[model samples]
Target: MAFLELHGLTKTFGGVPAVDELNISVETGEFLSLLGPSGCGKTTTLNMIAGFLDPSAGNIRLNNAPLHTVKPRDRGLGVVFQSYALFPHMTVSENISFGLEILKVPQGEARRRVEDVIDLVRLAGMAHRFPAQLSGGQQQRVALARALVIEPPLLLLDEPLSNLDAKLRDDMQSELRRIQRSVGTTTIMVTHDQSEAMALSDRIAVMNQGRLEQAGSPQEVYDKPASAFVSGFLGKTNLLHGRLQRGGDGIGVIDIAAHRFRASDDQTCSPGPVKLSLRPEHIRIGKDAEDHACRVSGQIHSRVFLGDRWIYDVNCVLGTLLVYGQSGAAPFEDAETVSMSWDAAKLRIVEAGHA
Candidate 1:
C-alpha cells in the first residue's frame, strides 16, 4: 500500500460538494503535489489530510492507519503555510522547538533537532533572530524548520512560498526540493502555481471542480494530457476544434477549415469531429524545420518577446494560434503571412469541447 492514501476523499458545504470522490496515492518518501486553480479543492484536500477539516465521505490513511479520527497534533504530520505563521517574539530556534516543547520532548533533544533542521534549511546563522527580523525567504525556512523539527512521518505544505517574490520563490523551489530529498519524508503539497508544481513534485494530480482530471509525472501530464481541460491548463497550447477522418498511408488526417493536417494513427480517436491540441513550442515558422514536416500558412497577428522566447499570435483559416520560438530566431512581422510546420507526432487528439 502507498504511504499516504486518499480514497473517495470528499468534502461538502451547504449540501454542495467542494471535493468530490477524489483519490490519489503517495509512495514512501515521495513528493506529491495537488495542483489546480483557485477554489478547485486543492487546499480543501490538504486540510482534510492535515486533520483540520472532516471529510463528508472518504478515508485518509497514513501508513495504513485511519487519519480521520486522529487529532491534528497526534497525526505525526508537519505543515507549512503560505503565511509563514511564525511567532514574532520567538527566535528561529525557539519557533522550531515549540512543537517539541508541546510534545514534552527532552529540552536537550529539542535543541539538537532544532539545530539540525536549521542547518537543513540553510538558516544556520539566523537561529537567534526573530521572525520580524528575517527576510521573506528566511521566515519561510523557519516555518519549514518548525514543521520538520518534530520529525513527522508526513509533511504537508500549503502554498508555502506564495508570499515570496518571484526570484526568491524560484530559489526556494530548488531549496525545498533539496530539503525533501535529504530527509526522505513522504510529502504532499498543495499549490496553484503550475511551474512550482512541475519543479518540485514526483507526481502531480491536476484537480478541477473537486475531481481528479489527471495524475502523472510532470512530463507525462504535460506531453500527454488526457482531456481538453488538462491540455489547456498545464501550459500554452493552440487548441484546434476540427474533424478527423481516415487518410492515406495509414495516417489519420484532421480537417481544420481549408487544411488537412496529419496525425499519428496511434492517437487518432473515433473518426469524426474531434479536437486537436498543438503546443506553441512545437510549431515552427519559416523553412527552419525538418524536411517533410507538415507545412501550414498563417498571418502574424501579434507578437511578444519574453527574454528566452518569442510568442507569436498567428491567424490562419483554422483559428488564431500561438507559437513559441527562441528569442534569437528572426521573428515574422505583424500581419505578415508565414509558413509554419510541425511533425505529425506533435499533433494530439483531445476532448471535443468548446474551442
Candidate 2:
C-alpha cells in the first residue's frame, strides 16, 4: 500500500467544490509536490491531507489507516507555513523544542533533539538568537527544523520558500531536498512555482479547477504533458492548432496553416483537429535545422537575451513560434531569415483548450 493515499478526496464551501474527486498516492520517504495556480485547489488539497480541512466526500488514508477521522493536532503531522510563524521572543532552540515539550517529552530528550535539529538545519551557533535576528533563509530553515524535530511521519510545507529572494530561494531548494533526504521523510509541499516543483519533487501532481490535471515525474510531465494546461503551466511552449493526418508508415502529419509537420503516431486519437505542443528549446534554428525531420523558413521577429539563453520569436508561414538558443553561441538578429526545424518525435499531441 502507498504510504499516503487520497481516494476521491473532495472539499466544498457553500455547495461549491474547492477540491473535487482528487486521487493521488505518495510512497514512503518520497517527496511529492502539489502544484497549480492560486485558487486551483492545490492548497485546499494540502490542507485536507494535513487534516486542517474536512473532506466533504471521499477519504484520506495514511499507512492503510483512515486519516480523515483524525483531528488536526492528533494527526501527528508536521507543517511549515509560508510565513514561518516563529515566535519573536523565543530563542531558536525554544521554537524547535516547542513540539517535543507539548508531547510531554522529557526535558533531556527534548533538549537533545532540539540540538540535533539545529545542527541539521545549520543553525548551531544561532540557537541563542530570536526570530528577529535571522535572515529569511535562516528563518525558513528554523521552521523546517521545528517540523523535523518532532519526527512526524509526514511533513507538509505550504510555499515555504516563497518569501525568499530568487538566489536565496534557489539555495534553499537544495537545502530542503538535502534535509528531507538525510532524514528520509515523506514530504508534501504546495507551490505555484513550476521550477520549484520540478526541482524539488519526486512526483508532481498538477491541479486545476478542483481536479487533478496530471501527475508524474518531472521529466515525464515536462516531456509528455497530459494536457495543454499542463504544457503551458510547466514551462514555455509554442501551442498551435493543427489537423492530424495519419500516414500508412506509422507516422502522422500535422497541418498548421500551410505548413506540414510530421509527428510519431501513437494512434490515441483519430485524424481530426488537434493541438500541438512544441517546446521552444526543441525547435532548432539555422544550421542546427539540417538534421531534423521537419523544417521551415521563418524570420526572427524579435530576440531577448536572458543570461543563460536567448528567446526568439520567429514568424513563419504558420504563425509566430518561440525558440530558445543557448547564450554562449551567436544569436540570429531581429528580422533575419532563419530555418527552423524539429524532430517529429519531439512534437507532443496535447488535449485541446487550456483545461
Model 2: weakest 10-residue lDDT segment is: 346-355
TM-score of 1: 0.96
Report the lDDT tens digits of candidate 1 across residue range 72-170.
Answer: 878978999989888888998889999999999998888889889999999988888888899999999899999998999999999998998999999
TM-score of each: 0.96, 0.97
Residue clash pairs of candidate 1: none
Which digits, one per residue and each the tens of the lDDT, describe model 2 over residues 71-179? 9999889999999999899999889999998899999989899999999999989999999999999999999999999999999999999999999999999999999
On lDDT, the leading prediction is 2
Clash pairs of candidate 2?
none
lDDT scores of the candidates, listed in order: 0.88, 0.91
lDDT of 2 at 277: 90
